[model samples]
Target: STQNANETQAVVASVLGLSANKIACKVKRLGGGFGGKESRTIPLACITSIASYHTKRPVRCMLDRNEDMAISGQRNPFMGKWKVGLDENNKLVALDTELYLNAGWSSDLSVAVMERALGHIDNVYYIPNVRAVGRCCRTNIHSNTAFRGFGGPQANVIAETYMTEIAERIGMTQEQFREMNFYKEGQTTHFDQELKDWHLPKGYFQLKEKSNFDARKAAIEEFNKQSKWRKRGISLIPTKYGISFTALHLNQAGAMIHIYHDGSVLLSHGGVEMGQGLHTKMIQVCAEGLQIPLDMIHIVETSTDKVANASPTAASASSDMNGMAVKNACDQINERLEPYRAKGLPWKEIVHHAYFDRVNLSANGFYKVPDLGYKWGENKGQLFFYFTMGAAVSEVEVDLLTGSHTVIRSDVNMDLGRSINPSIDIGQIEGAFIQGMGWSTTEESLYFPNGRLFTQGPGNYKIPGFQCIPQEFNISFFEDVTHESVKTVYKSKGVGEPPLFLGTSVYFAIRNALWYARQE
Candidate 1:
């Protein structure tokens, strides 16, 4: 488990100036981080380690909620300027964007965040002549760090904003414009990654039919016309998120599996469980690989001693890489137990024999995502192992008098190839979309003149609650998912950070209602 995969490296190499092995960071659990703990949390540990080193004794340092909020990083606020060129048929011909990200006070992870933003500038569309320039501006506040979706959410907002403007400028419905401009199966992205197993439009159209979007759009229009101070709107938005680290070295993972004499198993992997069910998935992966019942395998804690030099649990690739490593470890154990099974021995008897035979009951496994990463300078290699694709149809009703709004309904369709657990995957889809919705709509951060955060706690700031959820929400998976793009773990795609951008549909739908209101 990791917030900073390099925390030990940072403290060892930089703070104490000691060997990497001199320090070990142990992670027991993370309730919820949302990228807040990715890199910015390094400073906390570094400072504490320094205090302990100098004092020659144990030291504990903790901050209250106010102190944490006042000093810690926030999401990078962005300002973007763009120009889009569309052909006579409204097909995207070219797009040029200048994105300025506020990297408050320190650089932190701003560069990597900006790169993900630049890579995502096209979102789910294909623009032939697209050029994106990103600037990480220095500001006078606590350094902004990774939030959920990293830089992709900011980029999606810019792309969708211009897309909505273009649709209205040409007197076309938002749904029709977005559908017509989607990338076909053979299209390659601006960054040169080929769109294999392209299912963005597949899920998009299916969601359209399942949600009855066409009829609802017309019905909303009639309702808006009859109402005086309230207007209704509907929109369809799609997401295509790359599912690996942009940094090549972070693409590897390690797992350690120990089979005891009693045939019970202890599995340790290089992934943090932050209320996301990562440990549960790894247990399943281990159980499947070992061909045993789920109850026989128990996942130990995530610690540096268990799996050294592990990657951060961010990037949504923890499962993709860690699950593979667990599988490899299980395979090693199975191979050792093969002879016993050939002799018609049961699992417990095989384990007992293997323990007595000294057949290496403990296995260390490692895996590196093959053919991964992109060169920022060349901009021509694969940025991801594969892409996680999904689409959403959201309908919003906005109050003209008070500027309040309600989400009438939302429909989401995703291409999660052979979901390891449909219940968990759907929960992730729901949680991520709601979090993204909060970012785009009600969740606003304020600042004082001297660079102090005004919205430090829930009292001043707002997050989505039960009342803000859609009145009707539907979720469906693409039945014809193919893993030809990249053979991920269990032929399943990453779901943690991809469905987040689909929440922008609510924002776009609200914009549509506001657009119609402006006409009056």
Candidate 2:
């Protein structure tokens, strides 16, 4: 059970000139993936397998921190240029953008990543007559691969930047501009898929009210007028992220489960536990499906033998896919014991009787996301199962002397449908927000002229520290709303990647604060 364990097994088998079944891959857990381990782990496994095949002895390969940074890929660096035509009411009439992405050395996952970026160009808005093109430029540096949010965050940043600039140019608030262009139900995306159960507007107003955005803006303006060295600004941003693997076949997952005569259960799924609470959620899923105590279920380590041809656990869909698979497997076992339960037998007795009756107590479950199709040339058909929506309001104060800023406060309202675990979902929302803030403000990957990465270690690479956090952080989830189009396990939506886009508000807020300092 390795991260991207299925692909790693295949690659290793091919490298060793053996069948995939002959090789064994097992991983207990990953420290952190953040989309880095999805493909980057494959080469390491392949190289070690090759060495073992030739030497007829076990071999291993592991990269040091500096080597990993220098050799492994980073997120694709993009330079985007766009032109927009708007009506008098600030509604978008046309949008044409070209994105040049530095693919760096080789095309690892850049092609798929670029396709996602192009599809997400509109973000939460309805933009008709849109023409977005992505060009992957080959560079001399290490090949850039996937990161968290895949390419959705980069695409959303492009649209959000344009919205901010257009709002400033037209003398309207960014909030107003965003609201006017919000996607409504029945409206189609640029790719020709209908937007159903649109939640952007509702989420926007909820965040606006919760953050006291209008009053804070007025107060900041007044404070700026009185202060000489400090200025403050606030912004609200919305996100509508589509949930599914753009590649349709990669949307499927497999799970296996077994029940012991002692009433204990074992669960295995294709998803890796990267500290995102996937295993915890899986346990809850099994407990709920089997009506068993949480302590009775144990999640085993990931193994290619247990779940073959498994999809990588990125895209925030791990819970939706793997959790459903686990539930399905549990349901199968429960079905076999339903008659015993109907007879009013005890759970322990049911298990005891199940073994005596030769009733199968083991099951294999599989799930594939439905209705995902896309024609790249035409950009038509449904590429997503459903959309996850959220919004955030960020207030910031900028220093006039140094180009530094601090988040004064932040308010977030996200729709997680019916959350399976509120605590874990909230943690993901907050962590993604802070990581997005780091990407937008502090994390910059620098390189020398000779294509050497200069920011090789943590000392030079600035991540958002404790000090960068907002003094007043308020986070809440929308209540009583379920996704209309997609039926997930427990009616829950993906919470991993969508909230990262909410941090875009921080960037626009800092931009607004800079406007005042420039006027002075």
Candidate 3:
């Protein structure tokens, strides 16, 4: 495990016949990237830059299907054995897991990924005597990189699978088992982090009620009991996603806000958009902060030259960090306008008056969460932030003889911590859930013997189709849950990666359906 990112840069330079200084790499958004855009992109970019520099021409190289799949990284495939011990009421007591990650070639982000896996090994449950050890097994395949959920979904899947197995062993339904073990208020997790206001179980229970989880489970069981060729299954899945970058220092964020005389706003931050609507959400944040129309705010492209000394945009912390920074800037302007507001003028008029006063209407705000004490030798984990949970239930029908399955209906209830735009947030949740479903069920990657990927392009690989999406898709947010925002307009957490694990429920539902098929 070599420390520092520059080492990776140096290795890329040596392989590609370029000096490290000449690399001039730029970070940007990648559409539909499966963790391949992280450290794994350095080698390809270095090669391209070297080709361009030596030839003194516009040399362009792009990977075709096989080459791209071989060269590009993947979401690490993990094999873990978990034994969860629950008490009489299904309260989680202890958990032990052995995690083996297929960290192909050079370790890359494997250490961080595996550590994260171990860190979140218990998912949302409060389990004692939790023992999780991870080994990054070096293989001759392409290296794995960070996906949307990072290693969180993988680790959580293991825990949730344990939930399913335990439920089966105890002759209980999956929902009952999950509800019994869900994180309760004032409980300390395996990492010794005491959940100050943990509401995962409350949120999950609300979701269960809304999604008719009990009704669905009963129906599925009855259907499976009657059918010989087909079966049904349901699951209540929850996600307790930690919001900060695990590497402590990378958790800070900076933002620039410029408000013009006409009351228009220009916003710049480190986070990039990969069609996930990060930009749209940022605009909403700025608008809410300034108490102005959403149209008044404009988001600019993220650039190092503009927002200098910025952290890499990952970990679902962009909104939490940058949105707070923008709010800080807005507060500054609002403070200056307060005098005019004291004159009994409307806020807009106050803003207009302040603008004409030749107000120095530009600001840069920074945010680093305070009192987050993390020491290397402490052997303890205290969160700079806590996780928000969501529950998803998928009902699936499997054709036993054909070995095929269809998702007949799906229901989702997410606690996204005070959604700014309920409609937009729902769409995001639905999209991520669908994408994750594809990852588990439809999308599969292929690699050559020499560690090159074969399924590289859209032509070769297949994701989910419209037909595959459940017809009876239903979603709702938990009510009365305020965005406990300490720094921003509303205390809203990132809604990006958490819902991706909803696919786990879908996959397990399929598994349960298939189990019923096996009995038949």
Candidate 4:
């Protein structure tokens, strides 16, 4: 419990002039942070707790949406130029990019965030001489905050744009361009990260193939050959998202697993579940570890009192970290039961004796990823983990006269390592795709000059509704593929953020479709 939201403690800290060291804070599940809760939320809670302690009265202060939006942060509005050096074969040789991130009023977490952006600047491609220099421009805008992809989405979008530009310049198909440059085995990334032992390079490729990207491209080309009013475009993006806190040491998670006498199990981990099936995965993990039925386990909410010193569920590390922690705890209990199992005691009998003997049925487990290290300004960061690759082929119908773009069908092929829950996994892919679509085609941020956010109210800001959603959306995870070195037993990486970028591809595809329609 290091941070909180109460304002009273902050007021007291100001009045009594106490340092943060003199304060205690409590953290709970946040509905959504978009990176806002990473560190900044701590200060508010600390202030409130301090004030409550001093006032001897129940104290509470919550920010209204207007105040929340005005005072809180949104994704940094980045402006930059990107160029990729490619060989005649369309293989990417190098990338040069200059990024300007509007850091807003304070540094906050932008430095670390942008570092991750630069680290993942190439997304899933292999480019040797990649040079990406970023400047966190201090703008008067509300402190630019983090969203789902953090800086990864913005940074990767530029790469996708660069690919589109290259395809246009060479008259090669976008699919061809991507196929040529994707991070294949033995390919080293821009940050000098080596690509090794990929589970399903072909699995990702097959998704693109099954999605009929070539046919979609052909249809767009055919349409462009006839259209005159509007133009349509198609772009495919892949991700090899490294799952961890770049802070190395923060790449850890803790959990507590307890089995009651009645055979029901309680599970708590450091990662919070924000409707991402994190809790479901935890249940699966616990069940797998104990060789117990899934329904016998109850996954509990994340709390400091239960599993302390936990990391935020961001960076796509929730499953990797918490899964490991939970697995470790289960392994310990299994080890304790090994002696009884060796003596041919029934498993239930072992459990009964362990409880009767007052054996510690609860275990705290921890884990940190191994062999990942990085340094600043390195041409490549050695990747202990890789970017999970995916490609989307979207067809759209655009009304050129109205500047309205409608997606007809979308085919998403994503490298998800493995699908733990087929239905839940697809939902993650589909939901994120729609959300990302909103970010590109509909979601726009407006602000006032005095550093106030105008998107504070509902009417002023617009997010895509179902009416604007794509007509036919098809989402699939590359199932026959698996990553080898990944921590999970099934080699499944996080599916929460990568698929959001698919929505952007739909937007780009609509733009391409519009261009084609105009050519006709």
Candidate 5:
């Protein structure tokens, strides 16, 4: 629980040189983190604690928007050089890439981020010989920390950009090239982990059919031929994002559920909601597992006092890990009341009977993702429980004169593996896509030569706004899909981060439009 109060307590203890047990940290809910609050929150807390300790009074630290932007870490900016070898049919044969990440200042999470970039450089494709190297370059600016997709989005963009370039060189559609290189069921990644259940091909064709990709592509070509200043391009990109923390130890999560005498359930897990609807999904998991109504579950605030030593809610595995832990706790309670259930006892009656029988109404659950082992140096192991698959087709119109672009239409088909809550999952997908779009297009960070950030606020920097959204946005989930390796609660996969990679399609689509624009 990166957002847990304990994180602040630990920092405070370290700063004040006191025992951690003497410190107390409490948080109600985060306004919005998106990975910023994961580790960045600790410094402010520690500074305040130190000041209070010295002055013998309460102290607090707050940063204005400009100050915050100047000090806080942001998504890592990467410079990648890649060599891709393709066969006669434009299938990827071998790929060698070197990614240099601008890790401003200290190595906050740059090493882990670099590893993630190296791991994700393939981006749903299977190449017989692939090697990706990452270098973290230290600078005097603010350190770059985690964002939504971690480093996976940057890696996926690198791979997709090269793929798009290769497709253009070979006179093939990006969609065709992508489909041909999609990982099959038996294919192994460069890390030597065999893909157990691959759905990218099915998702690719499904999205193509649903989006009328071929027809729209032809129509765009015809329209581009007539238009002098504007050109439209369409591209379909696929993602097979491995789900789980690359570090095997971070794969575990814990939850505590307590059922009241009135049959009301109280659930708390290590995951911080962060406005991602994680608590809502956890409630749903408890309700589903305990066979109780949704309204009967009350989600308490995440506290370290309740659930200790929790992992950070990241890598898109928050729901998968926390939901399973909640389910496990609920299942334990249900198992204890099974005898009463077999007798057709009422829910409240069962709880009363269990109370009298000394059955535990409160239970703690712990879940560790199994069979995940990765040696960073060797770059080989079953690091992920399973890969979340998706495909997106984006049609964009580019202004050749200004090098500006607008996404005309976008279609997304993702496999969320029997979503726990379809609405929440869809929201996550849409939000991630838009955020990634901003990263690829409008969200540019600039710095002065002396290492001061010039884009310190919205006045100087641009982010995607309402106008940046696609005119026609269609998002759908693959039907009847579930994870083959991990037994997640409700058989659902993580939805937080995978769809961000889908935004790479928009970049390539704009690139395609630029190609036509350049010809004019």
Candidate 6:
């Protein structure tokens, strides 16, 4: 729904004659779009629509992997240069960064992606004086599109690289270097958004203790001193990902619910089910809102005809906005049924009476999350409603002879406030983390000098399969946590994209092992 509305606009413009009012774009739920489908889905639709209009028949366009690679884009490749001032103690004093993102063939979402990159280059650290400039550099290759973490991972990697290099310079562990500079309570981000509900420390310490990072670091040092061929390394990382879109208008969602005479419910929301369990959690939120059993509520696929001008299901804030919309719809119906309940009637009987008594059985609900803006000129505003805190420690063994590494173990700690559905949230965390791990570790993009991608298919490219996953993958959630800043449904935080950036722990761990191997 987020980009579907835009697709309609694109189609209308591409047709070169259709007025906006003459066309209606009805969209159903999409599958697993981590920002890729948001912008890339436009080109195919517009091209096909034009063909359909000329031919007077429905047109279908399908591109195989090679063809798709030839047209579509991958994550924008980034290059940055920076000047940093560190005090004698190696604490960061100021950071000035100028980033250039390869926009590829054209400027698609590269500018917006650059904005997110600039915002995240700080990566939760408290730098008193920081300045940044980002430019989208055009190239001859296919236009780069969005991937899972948007541009957060690329920027965070930059921050973490500096953190590690400084740590080594000062003879301190990466954890110590990072923790010493964390944004404490009552502090503010570079954008002047006052930091609140700080959970990074809470998760970082617990993850370190559980992962036994210090002991493992010591042991790895000793092992590397003896083993020349195989070197081991361990790294711990913390991340703070803000929820909501860079654009404020994309922060809202709508839901429509119907209560039948039999007390059954039909739920429709503008959230696409990309296998992150948005539908399942919405059902849970709906059932809990109406105080009904889960089986009593049914959700239909998201369609534009059902919810107009819906926001795209990116930003990891889908559940936040859609859940609130579902809650609003259920609340209205509950108010209508309150009288029947006071008469000591069952749910079905209440619905029967409410229907006959002329009480509205169907309600359309809408919600827009607050704190959706920031002022660049003044460097002030609530940029994020709340933070999704996470920390991870990954240990790896690198083969010095061949540039291959294996993740021995990974421990992750997340503070999701109170998860709507623990299982679904856990599944999201796992899936996002794994996908992110692939991006930083096994997934590499190669291109020929002529601007054509060489790794166009799986035969030439590689992705992390199950065999590459950490042998001891441990995940722990922060218990009894509640967000007091703003009441997001059930006090739950965003889960979809936050964990994706945490997977960089594996990359850094591999680097650490390689650093040891180089010494030998």
The lDDT leader among the candidates is 2
Tens digit per residue, CA lDDT, model 3, 76-100? 9999987777677778888878999
Regions of candidate 6 where Cα sits further than 4 Å from its true position: 1-6, 9-16, 19-31, 54-56
Report the Cα lDDT for candidate 1: 0.87
Best by TM-score: 2
Prediction-by-prediction clash tally: 0, 3, 5, 44, 2, 3
Relative to the true structure, candidate 4 reaches a TM of: 0.90
lDDT scores of the candidates, listed in order: 0.87, 0.88, 0.74, 0.72, 0.84, 0.83
Q: Which regions of candidate 5 fall more than 4 Å away from where they truly are?
A: 1-6, 54-58, 480-482
Of the pair 3 and 6, which is ahead by TM-score?
6
Tell me the tens digit of each residue's lDDT in model 5 across 284-319.
888888888999899888877778778887889999
- lDDT for 436 in candidate 5 is 82
The parts of candidate 1 lying over 4 Å away from their true place are 54-57
Q: Report the C-alpha lDDT of model 1 over 1-520, residue by residue, as the tens digit.
A: 2376556555645778888777778777887878888876777778877888888988777777777778888889889999999998889999999999999999988998998999899988879998899999998888899888889889988988888889888999777888888989978898898888997887888888899988998899899889989999888888889888888998999999999899999999988888888999999999889888999998877888789988889888888899999998988888888899899888889999988988899999999999876887797788878888888999999999999999999999998887888889999999999999998999888889898988888787798999999999988998666676568778877889998988889999998898888889
Of 2 and 6, the candidate ahead on TM-score is: 2
Off by over 4 Å in 3: 1-34, 51-62, 86-90, 261-263, 340-358, 458-460, 482-489
C-alpha positional error of residue 478 in candidate 1 after TM-score superposition, expressed in Å: 1.3
Q: How high is the lDDT of residue 19 in model 6?
A: 66
The TM-scores of all predictions, comma-separated, are 0.97, 0.97, 0.88, 0.90, 0.96, 0.95
User: What does candidate 2's lDDT look like per residue over 13-108, in tens digits?
Assistant: 887778999986888998988888988878877877777788999897778777889988899988889999998777998999999889999999
Q: What count of clashes does model 5 give?
A: 2
lDDT at residue 410 of model 6 (Cα atoms): 89
What lDDT score goes with residue 502 in model 5? 86
1 or 5, which is superior by TM-score?
1
